[model samples]
Target chain A: MRLPRARGPLTERLVACLQRPPRSHVALARTDGRDAADDALALWILHELHYRGFEDVDDAWEWAPSLMSMRHHLERELEERLRAEYSRSEGSRSGQAGGDEDVVAVLHQLIEADDGPSLADHLLRDGTTEQACQLLRQRSVYHLKEADPTAWVVPRVVGRAKAALMEIQYDEYGAGHHDRVHQDLFAHGLAAAGLSADYGHYVDEARLPILEQNNALSLFGLQRRLRGAALGHFAAFEATSSLPSRTLARALRRLGLPDEMAAYYDEHVEADAAHEQVALRDVCAVLVADEPHLREDVLFGAWACLELEARTARDLLDHWAAA
Target chain B: MAVEEPDVRPAGDGPLRCRPCPGGPLLVRGAAQVQGDDGTWHDTTRPVTAVCRCGASALRPWCDGTHKVLSQRGVNPIE
Candidate 1:
């Protein structure tokens, strides 16, 4: 995919910098920190450098030091913002997980206690086609590359955790069947919906929340220090997916959208049921056992996942309401 | 026509290990085929599969995570 239309000074500079050859001291764009779009888009582009590089950009730019400096700057800001939000969301509860607490139990409690807004519930109840399609576009930012962000944790972990992660990932990657791969299924869904099936097809139209959500996963996955958080976030994601996926499947059928697109959710309804059990019990629990110090980070990561999703839901719902 | 019947379960001594999740479904591994509620053998598809013990699942044999809503056990079903 080509670079998305630049959103601000940062992305504008990034778009231009990619056109040049590998350099040591290219000037990078700076943000005032208040505008999330400028920073989020810049960070998203930088993160993309590590994933599938843009068709137009030189691949050599990925390892350039100057770009790494820029990535670090944006990441620091993003991590700080995420940490603060996690803290604020904790408000009254004894925010920290006890060192000796059962990791799976804590994970279940963390996921169970979450009361965030449900986009699927809304789509199931009274969502219009416009709203549902809007949601599909927003979600494509991540679903198109599902399970990829968490794959980075494989190398960062060892012992049962690593093996357990692969056990879940095997199913996620279609268990050796290319046709069942989650990413391709989502691409098929996009095409069936009459939307673009290309990777990052709607990046240009992605809102601040969507970009930030993508950036958050990239940050956690790319940084070795955040492996616990990465797995935690993944557990939260899988744990919540099964039921909502069923709701979404019914919602899509109700709206008369193509059955092919709804079938993607139908697959998740069953897949995630098995995945959720293994993700929490085998992966996250084992990771915490191997490295007990990461327990809090796991909890924080789960919280961040829910928090970011809630923000995205609010942003889209509010936008739709206003429109 | 007396023909010898062949074994249909997963080959080797790899036992079909199953774990029951608290307030959730029974997770089964290494099963080539499973008997559904109607007593028909359905081919298992994934490396690991969730069998709906709660019986509230729309998917019948496979768990759709409806146990969470049945006994108020796991993630609350509705918003």
Candidate 2:
């Protein structure tokens, strides 16, 4: 996962600057980015500095004042875009519970009302082997480090929300079995599928929507101000995963993909069922209960999850249809 | 004479908590094992587990979220 190719002036300067040492007073261009993909990839690279960094990059850059300022700018733009996109859709504020309506129930309502293009259903019904392979390639950008982004929410929460979140995270970290860690399991699946299992391997080829989805997770999790949204995003992710995972497993097998790849989704079928329960009833609900003011932020985060995913699904399906 | 409640408290600071989630599975924690539908003792794998209540899961005794699908179709458990 060396620096991906520059998609625009922002990433072009970012990629070049990242290659050299983080010297003081290095001025970056003031452009927002060339296009949506360009902005997404540039922000993605900036976020990558916080994660396991690219080769030959200085660890100190993770907290460099200049880099942090640049990230703050990109993050603000991305956040504004996500909020505007979500609000522009029908009844965006409907996710907010009315007059003591249960937050968890409202989360369910948000999930149920989502009418996004179902990529899993497409794969199960009509996707070709090539489409499945391409999906897997794009998914590698996140699956290789599954569940890590959400871990940042730990210190920011407390009581039952914190405890419940730990329960979910511990299982994701694999319930005391090295062989069961979700990230490693996905790596095995990727290897079995004949794809590169290395972390950030497909980032260079990832579509803009994929980059946006990953960036949203990083943005929500890393910001203490957005902690409510982070948990909201996490809850939506888990609640929506189980049944679709069942569909994806069948789809992968139907496309004649390797069993190990399907096995990864098989694990999610049961795992996400439990994870969703804890996430909604315990994490999100309790967090909102303990602090009642975050109800809107929680809904906003959940909406971001659904809307961004809808965009990604539409992008891929439309691309395939066009081809 | 008291029958002693079988000393069923878990090995931790408290008794096992088995919470029946409305319209979902039974979320249980701090249990060492559970009796499956077939009467075999199944070791609880994680600290928290969801035991199937909808009876529609292919993975018996453990939920795979089949209840949500059932609810969507207006299907309710008879038992």
Candidate number of the best TM-score: 2
How much is the lDDT of residue B24 in candidate 2? 81
lDDT of 1 by residue, A145-227 (tens): 88888888889999888877888899989999999999889889889999988999889889888898899999999999999
Kindly list the interface RMSD, in angstroms, of each predicted candidate in the order they appear. 0.5, 0.9
Best by lDDT: 2
Model 2 stretches astray by more than 4 angstroms: A32-34, A96-99, B1-15
DockQ of 1: 0.73
Q: Provide the lowest-lDDT 10-residue window in model 1 chain B.
A: B1-10
- lDDT to native, each model: 0.83, 0.85
Worst 10 residues of 1 chain A by lDDT: A90-99
Per-candidate TM-scores read 0.93, 0.94
The docking category that best describes candidate 2 is: medium
